[model samples]
Target: MDLREESLYLAPLYSRFPLTIVRGEGVYVFDERGNRYLDFASGIAVNSLGYAHPKIVDAVTSQVKKLTHISNLYYTEPQIELAKRLVRLSGLDKVFFCNSGTEAVEAGLKFSRRWGKERGKYRFISTVNSFHGRTMGSLSVTGQRKYQEPFEPLVDGVTFIEFNDGAALEEELKKGDYCAVILEPIQGEGGINPARREFIETARYLCDKYDALLLFDEVQAGIGRTGTMFAFQHFGVKPDMVALAKGLGGGLPIGATIINNRVAETLHYGDHASTFGGNPLVTAVANVVLEEVESLLPHIRKVGDFLGNLLRERIAPLDDVLEIRGIGLMYGIDVKSNARNICERCIKEGLLVITCGKNTVRIVPPLIIGEQEIKEGVYILEKVLKEGSG
Candidate 1:
C-alpha cells in the first residue's frame, strides 16, 4: 500500500495522485486499501473498455497464448485485421502501427514530409496551445511554450498560430511551402477547445490548393471519445492523414497512423518501421476494442448528451464554474480558480478527475460509463469546487 517503492525507483516525471490504484472494473477503481472510487478520468481516456472487460481480457489472453509478437518482416492476421478495421472506420487507405501517440505523430510527420519530398516541401503548421505529443518532432508542432522552450533546436520549419483563426492559417498556407497542416480536431490539452467548422474547412481547402496534406492528431479525442469514430466526423470534415492512440488498444500500448492513398503511395518499404508495432497481443485486443466501441457509440452519444445537459443545469450555475464546454463525453468545466486543487481534492472524496489547460477540469470517462457515474463525478467535483481544498 505504501508508495515508498514507487517514489524510490521510478523517475520523477509524472506528478502522480497519492492513491495506489491496484484494480478497476466498470467505472470504479480501487486503491491498495480497497477503497473504491468512481473513475471519470479513465486513465486519461486510455481505458476505453473501463477495465477488465471480458472481451478485451479474452482477446489478450488468447493472443498471448498463441503469439505475442512478430517483426514487420513477416505478416500477422491480427495486425492485418486491425489495420483493416481502422482504415474502414476512418475512410483512410492504410495504417502504420507504433507504440504510443508521439510515435504515431512522428510517423505522420514523416509520411507527410515524404509525400511532399519531390516538391521540396518540409514545413509544418500547427495551432497555438495545441498538444500533439512530447517527442522532438511532435513537440516541434506543439504550441505550448513551456514544453518547447526546454527542448530547443527541435525539428525546424514548424509555425505555431492561433486555434480557430482561419485567416492567419490561410495566410501561411498561401506560401505553398508547407508539407502538411497538422491539427487536433478538438484541442484536448489546451482546454477542450474544438476547432471551428469554418477553420477546418479552410484548412482542407488550403491543403488542397497547396498540394499539402491535412493531418489530424486525434490522439486524445478519437476512438469514440467524442461519441463518434473520430472528432473530424463531427464537423463532417476529413483529414488526409490521422494519428491515433490513447483509446485505440483498450488499455494496452498502441499507436496508429492512418493515411489515405496520397500518403501511402509514397511510403516505400523501410521508409518507416516499428519492431513491436502491430504485434499480436495489442492488435488482438484493439480489434475487440473496435468491436466494443462500435456497439457503445449510440449509447455514448445519448448518455454523453444527458451528462452534458446535467452539468449545464447543475455545475454551470456555480459562481466558480465559468462554463461547461465539450462534445460527447469529452467535457471540461472551466473553473474561475484553482482547477488543479479541485482535481486532487476530488480524489479524496472518492472520485477521480484531472485538469487541462489552466483552469479546466477534464472529464473524459470510459465510453461505457452510464448516467449515474456522471452525476456522482459531478457531485464530487461540485463539492471540491465549493471547498477549493487541495
Candidate 2:
C-alpha cells in the first residue's frame, strides 16, 4: 500500500515522520520514492542486527517452515535453548517469556508482588521521569506523570523518587512497604541518563536489607547495546530480576523476565503463561540474535566510542548543544531547542533520528553499525545544526 493510504488505515497513535520506509538493509532504509537514508535509530533500537542478515533470515524461515508455533504444553528446542542462553548470560536462575517489553515488566511486577505476598508489601518504587511501559501494571511504576495521568486510577501503590538520588531511594526503601524497586540502568525515554555507581550499589544493598527485589528494566539498554552484554554489568551490581525485550529477538516480538532462584522458586506453575510467549519461531530468531550479539558486542563498543567521539568533535561546538551523555551505542544530545525539530531536519537531510526526554535527540543504531555509517550520519546532523544555528 502507498504511504498515504497506509496512514489513513492505520491508527494515529504515532506522529510518524514524513518519510515512509519501504525496505531496510544494512544501516540504511529506502522510502517509497527510493530515497535512501542512514538509519541511526534502528527502529528505536529494535533492529540491532541492522536489516535482513542472512543468518537471521535463514534461521527464522527454517523455523517457520518446520514449526512456527506450538502450545507451551509442549517443548521446543529453540525455546529451551534460547532460555538457557539468556539465563546463562544474565546469571539468573529462571525466565518467563512474553511478547513485548511491557509484558515482561508486568510479569516482573506480578512476580515481585507474589514474592512479597506474605508481608502484604505491594508497593513499588520507580525513578522520576522513567518510562517503564504503557501497560497498566508497568505504567503504574513509571515515574512520568504525563503518561500516567490520562490512564489514571492506575495499578496504584507506586511511589516516584528522584533518579540517582541515593538518599531519597534509601529513605523510601527503609519504609519497609516496598516489594520491588524498579529502574532502567540507562533511562531511554527519560533522556539517556545512566545510573550512578553509588546509586546502583545502594539499591542492591537496600533491597537486600529490606527484603525487596531490585528489578532492572533493560528493555532499551540490553542485548549488548551497552559496551557490556548488559548495562548492569558495568556497575558490578546484579538485580533480583531484569525485564528485556526490544533487541532480544532482533526485530521479532519477544520479551523475557529473568529472575533469581529466590523469586524463581516463589513462582509456581500457572502463575503466568503466554500463548506466543516461547513459540519456536520467535525464540529461534532470538537465539540467532544472541549469537550475533556475541561477535558484534566488541564492535559495538569500539564503534559506539567512535560515534560519541565524533559527536563531541562536531556537535559539542554548536551553540544550542547542551550536552552529550550515554555509553556504547546509546547516546543522546541534549539541545537547547526542540529535539523534534532537529530530528525532522535530519530526516530531510537523508538521515533518520528520534527524540527522547524533554529536548534530546536519541542515537541508538544497530549494533552492527560501522564507523563509516556513523560518520556520515553525524555529518548530516552537523550540517543540519550548523545551517540552522545561523
lDDT of 2 by residue, 129-149 (tens): 999999999999888888999
Q: Write the per-residue lDDT of candidate 1 for residues 1-390, one digit (tens) a residue.
A: 567887788998888878789999888999888999998898998998898998888898898899998788899999999999998999989999999999999999999899988988989999999999999999999999999998899889999889988889889988888999999999999899888899899889888987889999999999999999999998888899999999999899999999999889998988999999999899999999999998899999998998889888878888888888899989888998878878888888999888998689999898999888888888887777767623
**Which segments of model 2 are wrong by more than 4 Å?**
1-7
What TM-score, to 2 decimals, does candidate 1 have?
0.98
Candidate 1 local accuracy as lDDT? 0.90
| Candidate 2: Cα lDDT at 300 | 85
Please count the clashing residue pairs in each candidate, in the order shown: 0, 0
Instruction: Return the number of clashes found in candidate 2.
Output: 0
Whole-model lDDT values for every prediction: 0.90, 0.91
In the predicted model 2, the residue pairs found to clash are none
